[model samples]
Target: MNFYTVLEYIGMFLVFVGALFLFLGALGIFRLPDVYNRLQAGTKATTLGAFGAIIGIGLMRPEWLPKAILIAVFILMTNPISSHALARASYRRGIKLWDRSVVDRYGPYLREKEEKEGKR
Candidate 1:
């Protein structure tokens, strides 16, 4: 097979893999017990899924490579950061963790910081 044809096959495979992960992410978001867990599932899965899909599309269309790379970079940068900000906000807003959650690391750290700063 020619190189471009090989790339097309690889791109198609990646697109399918990406779609599968995206579907799984949606399922996790729907089925998870709490917002924190759902956010964790959605953020991590979709970041990789979208990056793969964008790069796959770029491979299929050589002219789109630069734009796809930029979009992938943006997703990689923003998804996790936004997920973190949302989780922290939810925790500060008095959202409770899932009943089975084992540790409370952030709560203790925040309390220490607040106590040191003398702020509520």
Candidate 2:
């Protein structure tokens, strides 16, 4: 096979892998028991899946690689922070968590904020 053809095959393979990850994430979003778990599904898996697809496209289209990489990097930087913000907001608003949830890391933080506000 030619060089471009080989790259195209690899790109297609990566696209398939990405699609699989996206599907898994979607399934998890539906199947998960809590907002935190759903957010985890949406943020991490979807970001990786999207990044994989973009990287695949970049592999197939060398000239577009820079833009693809930038998009992936932007997503990597923002997705987790956004998820964390949403989780914190939900926690603050008293959203119910899964019965199986083991820990509440943000609880102490919120309590501290409440105490500080009360003192103020």
Candidate 3:
């Protein structure tokens, strides 16, 4: 009905949304067919889920908002980078994609780079 109370409700809703994403992310990790797919599912989900839940808690607590925002920023910056690094490493190590995967975008890019370096 009032400002803080309204924030509480919104915070609760955000927390619920965050939790739902976290759950779906887990399911994706479990059900996805490959490392790249799983990494994508996990990273994207955790970023949104964690940011939502953290910001929700910050709203509820008020005092924690700055720290919450900081943590959320860290997650936003790191999650995708880390996931990309992991996927790149896996690719370099010759991890095979799922059999039905239709594209090998990175393969061509890598070959082009290799060809250029060899020519150098």
TM-scores, all models, native as reference: 0.91, 0.89, 0.91
Instruction: Tell me how candidate 1 scores on lDDT.
Output: 0.92
C-alpha root-mean-square deviation, candidate 3: 1.4
Worst 10 residues of 1 by lDDT: 111-120
Tens digit of lDDT per residue, candidate 1, span 1-120? 899999898889988899989998999999999999999899988988999999999999988999999999999999999999999899999899999999889888988998989964
lDDT by candidate, in order shown? 0.92, 0.89, 0.93
Model 1 TM-score, 2 decimals:
0.91
User: How well is each residue in 22-82 modelled by candidate 2, as lDDT tens digits?
Assistant: 8988998999889988998988889989989988999899889899999989988998999
Query: Per-residue error at 115 for model 1, in Å?
Result: 3.2
Q: Stretches of candidate 2 above 4 Å error? A: none
* Candidate 1 vs candidate 2, lDDT winner: 1
Cα RMSD for candidates in order: 1.7, 1.5, 1.4
Residue pairs with clashing backbones, model 2: none
Error of 2 at 105 (Å): 3.7
Candidate 2 scores a C-alpha RMSD against the true structure in Å of: 1.5
